[model samples]
Target: MTTDAVDAPSGRSASFTVLTTGYTLSTGPGVAATVSYVTDGGRHVVVDPGMVAHRDRILGPLAELGLTADRVTDVVLSHHHPDNTLNVGLFGEATVHDHKAEYRADQWLDRDADGHALTPSLRLIATPGHSPEDITLLAGTPDGVVAFVGDLWWRPNGPVEDPVSPDQAVLRASRERVLAVADVIVPGHGAPFRAADALL
Candidate 1:
C-alpha cells in the first residue's frame, strides 16, 4: 500500500498532537524518520530530528499550529541513526538530549554544552537493538504514556531485523521494557498506535 502522512491528537488530552512526516522508500532505501512532537505549556520537544529532507517538512506544519522551531526547547532523539539525528544541528540553541551511549560531539546533545533539562514528564530508556546508541523516550502526558521507539519497530510492518546484528538480544529485551510501560507506541516511521500490549 502507498504510504501517507497522518497526524492524531491524544484521545485523553486536547493539548498534544502527534505528527508523522511519512517515510521515503526507494529501490534500496529503507523507511525514513517518523518525527514526533510534544507540546506542553507552549514548550516544544521534537522526538527524532530525522534527515534534512524531512526536517523542513516536519517544522512546516508547526507554524500553522502556532509553533516554530525556535520555540522548540528540547530535541529528543530515540537513537543515533543518521535518519533520526541528521537534522539535530538545525536547532541551534535547543537542548539536545539522547542516550549518553549514542551521543556525538557534532550531534545536537552535548552534555558539556548548555541545553535544557530532561523534562520530568519524559524519561529516556536505552533500547539497543537497531543500534548500540538506540533509545526510546517515554513521555508522561496528561493523555497517557507515549513511547517513541526509534527503529526499534515500525508500525503495521512490525520489527525491522538484522539477523547477524549483535544487539539482536538487547533489541528484544528493550522492546519488552517499552511494551511493559508505554500505553501508546510511536514507531520511527509510521502513525502512532494505541497498543499498550504490542511488543517487538
Candidate 2:
C-alpha cells in the first residue's frame, strides 16, 4: 500500500528542546517516518518511534544528543501503526503513552478539553482517524505551540495522500483540529512546516 510517510528532511529545529529527524528511517528510500523529539531539559520525549526494524534510525537523533534509549523519559505513540509505534520497546524503562481509547471502549476522555497536563507545557490531544488512537502532541515552547501530528496527511502534493480511508470524515476532522491550533506542524510524513493559518 502507498503510505504518506516520507524521509524526514534535514537541518530543522522546532522549539523547546525538539529536533526533527532528518529523513527518519533506514528502509531505503520512499518510506520513512518523520520522527521528532520533545525534551524538557532533563527529560527526553520521542514521537513516532518508527519500525522496530529501523530502531537505529529512530534512535539516531537521541544518540547524536549524547543520549541512549535509557535517557528517554517518555515514548509517545501517535498510533500503533508499524511505521510509527513499532520501536517503543527500545526506549527501555520509559513510560509509554497513547490515546487511552486504544485499550478500552468506555472512559473516552478528551484530554485537551479537560486540561490534562503533560508537563508545564505539553498538552495531549486525542486526534483519531489516521487510526482510532492517533494522538497529536502540542508542546508550549518559547517560540509557540509546535504540534507533532502523526499521519494526518502528507504535504500539499509533495507525495502520498491515501485517496480513501476507513474513516475519511474523522481524519479530516482531526487534521482540521490540528490546523486550528498548532503554529508549527511536525507531520507524520514530510518536513516540519508552518500550520497556523495554513490552507488545509
Candidate 3:
C-alpha cells in the first residue's frame, strides 16, 4: 500500500483541542479512543468520537467551548472499528467522512479521502496499517502541522510495532509518511506528542 507524501494545506490555519485523552489498559482489555475537536473557520470537525468513560467526557469540553453536538459540521472516522466509531450517531447532522466516502443523510458520496480538503487548513490522507481502511486527519495550524493518526501509533513511545497490524511493513511505511510532514501527532489512544520525540 504505497501512498504519496501528504502535502500541507495552504492558506488558512485550523485550531484543535483534545476533548478527552484516551487510554488502553493492559489488563482486562479496557480501552477508550481519544476524541478531538477541530475548528477551521466555520467547519467544526470532530475526529473519532469513540468509546469513553462517559459521553460527557466527549461533550463536556464542547460545552466549555460553547458548542453543541449539532454545531459540529463534520465527523471523521479513521476507521470503522467499534472502539473508534461508537458515538458517531451523536452528531446526527454532521457529514461523516471516512477513508472512501462522504456520508450525509441519504447521500453517500463516493470519493477518495486522500488529500481531500475539508477546509483550506484541514484535510484527510490515507495511512492504513492498523486497519486497511485507516486514514489520518492533517491540520495546518499556526504552530505547525498536526496529524491525528488513529492507531497508526498507540502513543509516542509505542509498542514499537502494532501487535494487530495486518502488515508490519505497510505500517512502518505509513509511520514514515506521517513523520515526514507532522510536527506533532495526536495518537489513537493517547495525548498529543511531538513528532521529533516519537520512538518510531
Q: Give the top-scoring candidate (TM-score).
A: 3
Native-to-model Cα distance after best TM-score fit, residue 99 in candidate 3, in Å: 0.3
Tens digits of lDDT, candidate 1, 1-200: 21100111122221345555546463125556777787554458788878635456777766767777777777788766677777787676576777662243455333421112245555566677877777676666776677788778756356546442467778787777677666788887667877554655
Candidate 3 positional error at 1, Å: 20
lDDT of 2 at 152: 69
Question: Which candidate would rank higher by TM-score, 2 or 3?
Answer: 3
Comparison by TM-score, 1 against 2, better one: 1
On residues 1-200, what C-alpha lDDT tens digit does candidate 2 reach at each position?
Answer: 11111111111232443333434333235556767778764557888777533567666667887888888787777877777776677776676667762211233333332223456566667777767777777776767677787776544222233453468778777777776666787777566778753444
Model 3 lDDT per residue over 14-109, tens place: 999999888888622589999999999799999999998889999999999999999999999999998889999999999999999999989999
How big is the positional error of residue 109 in model 1, measured in Å on the Cα after superposition? 8.2
Model 1, residue 67: what's the lDDT? 76
Clashes, model 2: 1
Give candidate 2's whole-model lDDT.
0.62
Candidate 3 — which pairs collide? none
Q: What value does the lDDT take at residue 195 in candidate 1?
A: 57
Off by over 4 Å in 3: 1-6, 27-29
Model 1 pairs whose backbones collide: none
